[model samples]
Target: MTLVSTATLLQDAYARGTGVAALNVITLEQAEGTVLGAEQAGLPVILQVSENAAKFHLDDPGPLAAALAVLARTSQVDVSLHLDHVTRTTLLHRAAECGFSSVMFDAGPLPYEENVATTREAAWWGHEHGLLVEAELGYVGGKASQVESAHGDGVRTDPDQAREYVAETGVDALAVAVGSKHAMTTAEAELDLDLVARLREAVSVPLVLHGSSGVPQPTIAAAIRAGITKVNIGTITTIAFTRPIRQKLADLPALNDPRQYLEPARTSVSAVVAEMVATVGLAGTQRS
Candidate 1:
């Protein structure tokens, strides 16, 4: 299959009441593993490159983006590239040229008016280039700081405000703070399913769930049923990819070759992706 657009995938999922797995990609192996896992499940997947991940690769996303583009173009199942949590306008501007079909312009932490202004401009530019633009509404905490209680702290998005924000920003998707926190190693976050349903009814576009790695599989499925169209998973994938490598290194201290460990790590990622796809009820939902 050829590389597809994220808007197309999300629209289909939104209409079908299913969720699409948008797994974070930090390396070539991770990107390959994502596609392999989606192919294994016969479902479409989005390869998301975060702003931090782009900075990791020498502050330029072009090389990694190019590799992902090639991988998606040749993949067995439908695949879309997305730039996730991009705070810089420059990066948003460069997203289409980098072969990304969608971008999440994160301005949620800023003042409400500022977030609206920036996101609106980003959506306008993204539309001009045929890119699916996504933006965060409420602050989904815990990526850079200590994990906050998912249900407390006024972090959850307001349904009424979300409706206005979407209309004001014209974004294609909205990432809301339900209960999950970023970088959580444990799957204990309890989502507010009622809020999810309310937000779904509040906005016309698809709703995105960030920090989904912290939510249990059953809960994820329930959230999807409640109206989460896109699920952004990162921490668990990194944990899965890193644990095996650590174990291998501990078992073979003198192993100098990278492939010996990276191969198993990639396999771990593939397994996680497959499980996540099933969790989202997207298994065997491949499109022609």
Candidate 2:
């Protein structure tokens, strides 16, 4: 009935053998729709703001984050605010200041040592600030200079390396790369279930799957069963949010009010989110 910690959601999913859906939002509509969808499905969800999305708001996501925090507090189901794929330490601190319950500190593109050092610092800051920290160990593309590798076979998270990374960084959750490519327009990424299970066993922390937009429904369920507790979805929300707007614009050329088209797009995103929640087996699963 109110905002909860990301750690609670992840731990609950791990205990239940299910996946928690973490959706990326750009606008307030997306944020509202994400929570509305979760409420409709009677499931708890995480509303995330990505680094690129924050840049779109002029590098200050405070307003949007505050809005999401309010929405979570007033929602009928549990919802949490999280910063996704953050590359800078400043941004991570800003996110916590903005009332975010958790953040994914992205240092996977850096050298292993540098990444470990930076992530450790982030985890320390997060813990001190009362925020849950999520960090990625292997490369999962589709942002910044990593765009070139967005669609390529991602560097799978090494089991041994993952164990060490968690032990050294003290991250609350670990996002693993297991063949899911970011920014995919279609759902066709083939996941390595065996690797997922191996990584789950190797790492003591809960596992996260990035680029989940490219993963189909059945595959997502299978990945969850194999030990993925958190699944991050971005591209599909954009697709769902834009398709109706384009269609409405084309159908009504004289429509001057933005709400006329944007409202439909927001509704579409809500439908997609509800569907994803159900697919992740979170629907109707009440939180204690």
Q: For residues 189-208, write the lDDT of model 1, one tens digit per residue.
A: 89999999999999999999
lDDT of 2 by residue, 1-288 (tens): 898988888888877778889999999987877888888888999999998899999999899988998999999988888998899777988977898889999988888899999999999999999999999877776666553553355467889999999999999999988888789889988898999989989987888989999989889988888888898998999999989989999999999999998898889999999999878755223322
Best by TM-score: 1
* Lowest lDDT block of 10, candidate 2: 279-288
Off by over 4 Å in 1: 145-147, 283-288
The residue pairs found clashing in candidate 1 are none
Model 2 pairs whose backbones collide: none
lDDT of model 2 at residue 215? Answer: 88
